[model samples]
Each structure stands twice: as structure tokens, then as C-alpha cells.
Target: MKRSTLYKDELIVQIMGMTDKLQRRFQSEGVDEERSWMLQQTDNPAVISFLKRATMMMLHVIDAIVALEPVNGIRIASHLGIPRGSVSKITRKLVQEHVIQMEYLPDNKKKIMFRTTSLGKEVSKVHLALHRHVNMNVHALLNRYTPEQLAFLAQVQSDILNTSLVKEDLASIKDDPPPAAENPPEAMDMRQAAQEDPIRDLLDMLHQLDSANLSKAKDLLQVVFFAGHNG
Candidate 1:
């Protein structure tokens, strides 16, 4: 095999360092309790300027709809691992913005589907361009590695997972613990509640997850991980 630009000894040392770093990062509960600076700063345009105006989760829904169109709300909810009701609300906003359209099967009459409109396609193109720009920049760092070395690096990264306790860890948590709700005596809607008290809402959701689906749930709730990491 062609050697990597990173020498084998250096590669091994870095991998060991990576494992230790991962363990320390995951073991800290204080990390999860802290608010994320990025989430708090809604006006930052370092990423996608247009996309930054709305909730970050909306982009995931928009991108998925483009890729899996002629799909319905239920499938979108499954794809994103969000509640069906939440997907319904997001899709409604997309429809209002002319980003997507709802269609029904002529034969079935009741079967609903979602498809991206022309405007939605334009938005998707911009979204995809942002991802491509970032990927190319990141891949520049890997260009010096031979194809074989890149493959080995991918394998090593995949082999380092330690998710066995995810379910055990999830199971140990209490069910549907009430949010602090301390500040708001008046009844605020779900959207306001989410924006005002993100952490409690997250715990309420985690209380509903289980070992069987926690991984998929986490895959979709990556913003949670980002919040923890950024905190």
C-alpha cells in the first residue's frame, strides 16, 4: 500500500489522542447544560446568510424534501426523526413560502404527498452549493493522502464508535420532566417555548426516546450535539 502523508507512527498517536479527547468530551454533563453561543446568535452570516434567518432545523427539512419528493409528511417526519406534528408545522411554512406543494394521489384521494416547487428547487440549489463549498474545503486537507490511506482513515474513524450506552444512558433518564416554566406564568405557544427554553424542551423529548430508536433520534437531533459541543 502507498504510505500516507501522515506517517504511521504519527497516525497512531493522533488516533489515540482522538479517542481520549472523545471520551472526555462525552463524559461531561456540564457541557450539555450550557447554552450554545451559536444558537443564541441568530444574526451570524458565517454559514448560509439566507438560511441563517430561520431555524437551522428547517434547512434539514427543506433538503430532505428536495431529495425525497413525492414523499408525504409522515415519511418526512420519519426521515428527520421529529414529531409528525412538528413536521406538519414546518411543511405548512414551506407551503406558505411556496417552497413546496402538497399533492394527493388521484386514485386514493386521501393519500397526501409533498413536492418541491420551482422556488423550492432554487432554494435547494443554494443549500446544496453551501454544502459543496464546505466539503471541497475540508477535502483539501485529505488531498495529500493516497486513496488507500484515505480508505484506511475512514475505516479507523468508523471503528472508534462507542455508542453502546446510548440506550442505557437514555433509559436512565426520567420521563417527561416538566420544563422550568419558571419564567413564564402566561401560556406561551410551542414555538415561543422552544426559543425561550431550549434545554427543557430537549429533555422532554429525550424522555420519550428509547434504546431501539435513540441512535436514529440522535442522528436527526445533531443540533443537540452541536449545542453541547459549542457550549
Candidate 2:
């Protein structure tokens, strides 16, 4: 195997091990109130799946509610590039959780409008904080890289995933309901690509990074790639 490719393989194993540790920590650490609450919700499994799948959608929905006016299911689906049917299902669950609330305009009683409740807004803020945590961490890493290294990292990533994007398995939605809820749309699309290509599914998630963090990610990746070469 090429040295860089071999290093990437080892890196994937290390990351998987780190993820295993995080999973164990999350399971055992009942002291953290926030994580504790989320853990408690895992009893149903549906709640956990819903939150994981809808987090990005919720973030955008909350932003729309705060920055613009109230939005409806279609608006949310359109904004997130998912199916309206998905928006409907997730909004119903969010309403059940008392996270989002539905209302109607005075003249149009039939028209349902969606808005984030106080609880929903708080959850969105929490998610935003998690997003910022990664963003800041990557930026910190970028401080150590040169521009060429950053560019190379970006190029390598693009080259790796260059062949095709994910193809959604919509059929699974009908056949297997619960498991489908855990995979986000991006995940559904890129899963086969990652598996068949022998690349990381994480590269698919890189699209979620904000522009600044994405730039940082390139630099950080470059550092990892080159450091492997040197070592």
C-alpha cells in the first residue's frame, strides 16, 4: 500500500477507537446533566434517532424563526433540501416533545405555521454550541498549517470522494422504519460511496461545516497527511 493510504487506514482505526471511548463515556457519565437528560430519552430509541436526524433541520428551522417570520413544513423541507413528508414527520415529533409549536394566520386557519418554543430555541442553542466547539477546535489546528498544506488536504479529500455523491435509499424508508430515522439524508446518500470507495463517511459530513471551519479543516487535514508522510 502507498504510505499515505496506509497511514489513512491506521488513522481510521484510531478514530473508531476514539469514537468507541466517547460512546462508553456517554453511556457511563451520568453526572453531566445535559448528557444525562439525553441519555434518559434514549429509553424510547425513537427520540434519540429523531434528534440525531433532525438536528441540522432544527438548527435551520430555529434560525428561520428567529431571523425571519414563522415557517411551515414546506418552507422547512425546502430550506433543508429534504422531503416535505420528512418535515411533516419531524415537526409532528417536535410538537409532541414541546420543542416546536404550530399556529395559524388569522385569515388562513387552514394554513399551519411553525415556530420554535422556548425549549426548542434552547436546544438549538445547545446544538449551535456543539457546532462552534468543532469550528473553534479546527481553527486552532489551522493556526499550525501553511496555505499549501491546507490546499493539499482539501484536494486529497476531494479526490477521495470525487467519483460520486450518495444515492438516497428511499426504499428503506418503507421497509425499515426505525433504523431509517437514525441516518440523515447526507448519510443515506454517502454511505454506499464511503463503503465502496474505502474512504471515511466523515468526509460526507464535512459539507455541514461553515465556510471558515471548512477552510480550517483543509489545513488540519493537510497537517495530518504530511505529518504521516514525514513520520
Candidate 3:
């Protein structure tokens, strides 16, 4: 029984190793495809600029939704750790921008309800795609490690995730408005509310670059990883 249990544990670890490798392989290819898609979508300078601001804005809107009760503007902002006035402004802008919906509660005249619209959901999905693109590329090299190596790597990743890496990433995105007529300063302001996030910066970087950086980043990543230890 003891031997059987130990074998199962080892097997699980081995499987984890394989899965991690597969994840990296998938990400490497996926980042290539994602970059292609991003390029096609952002061919115009105006579009690229607008997307940068839009991406930042949408993240805060989503954060509010995830953290709050989908209640009205004031309450949602209050619950989600944002200023009520900022929430009200962003909510109104989002509704006008057609990324979210606001409906008055039936029983209450003063209270209103808010939720992501179909458009909002689509934007959110795109944002998620952008996030995944960055994550896969950044962690793609981890698959090269052995099972024991992967176990240690995973712990390190978890620790990093829980720390300021996230904050550092968010702070990288610049809040300056894009030069497009379609995307106004109001758009930039709302977006700036969430610009202090690392994930958004990573996505922005991925959206701006080609696959060449992917390989370089991967090689540099391996160098950094291997530099710390004996094996």
C-alpha cells in the first residue's frame, strides 16, 4: 500500500510535468498567433492607441463588476474600492460607449442596477485573450524543467503571483491619450483608473510587439531561471 501510494504521487508529479510542458508549447505557438491577430487588429496607429486606453478602462469596469454586487453605479464603486464619483462617471461613459447596461431597480427609484452587456462581455473576452497571450509567453519556458524542477518552479510562480509582480506589470502602462479622434480624453481618463495594473501592461506590450521578442524573452527567461541554482 505504501509503495502504491508513493507510485501514485510520483505519477501525479510526472503528469504535472508533462502538462506544464504542453502548456508552454501551446503558449509559444499561441503567442505567435495572438501577435498576428493583434497586428491585424491594430494596423492603424489610431486603433492601437484607442485599444490601449480601452483595454485599461475595461479592466477597471470588470474589476468593479467582479468585486461588487452589480448594483447601481454609486454602490458598485463603493463596494469595489473605487471612488463613487469615478464609478458614476465611468458607468455613464461605459453605457454611452455601449460596453455596459444600466437598469433602474423596480422597487427603488433611487437605486439602479448595472451589468456587463453583450458588447461588454465580448470586450472582456478579448481582454482575457490578451492576458492569456502574455501569460503563456512569459511562462512558456517553464515546461523545460523536470518534475522536481517543475514543482519548485510552480511554487516560485505562485509566490510571485501573490506579490508585487502583478503591481509592477500594471504600473508599466502609460496613461497618455491616444491621438485618435474616436478615442477622447474622457475615454483615456476612465481607462487610466485601471492603468495601474501589471496584467494590462503585459497585454499592451504583447499587442505592440511581434513574435521575435517571444523567442528572445524565452531565452532570457531560461537564463534567469538557470542562473539561480546548481541544476
**Largest lDDT belongs to which candidate?**
1
Where does candidate 3 stray beyond 4 Å? 1-55, 63-70, 74-81, 141-231
Which candidate's TM-score is highest?
2
lDDT per residue as tens, model 2, 54-129: 5455556666554444987787777777888877877787788777888999999999998887767666665555
From the highest lDDT down, the ranking of the candidates is 1, 2, 3
Quote model 1's TM-score: 0.44
RMSD of 2: 19.1
Name the TM-score of candidate 2.
0.47
- At residue 76, what lDDT does model 1 achieve? 93
lDDT computed for candidate 1:
0.66
Worst 10 residues of 2 by lDDT: 174-183
lDDT of each: 0.66, 0.65, 0.63
State, as a TM-score between 0 and 1, how close model 3 is to the true structure.
0.38
TM-score each candidate: 0.44, 0.47, 0.38
- In candidate 3, what residue range of length 10 has the lowest lDDT sum? 175-184
Residue pairs with backbone overlap in model 1: none
Q: What shift in Å separates residue 225 of candidate 3 from its native position after superposition?
A: 40
Question: How close is each model in CA RMSD to the real structure?
Answer: 26.4, 19.1, 25.3
Residue runs of model 1 more than 4 Å from their true location after superposition: 1-52, 80-83, 145-156, 165-231
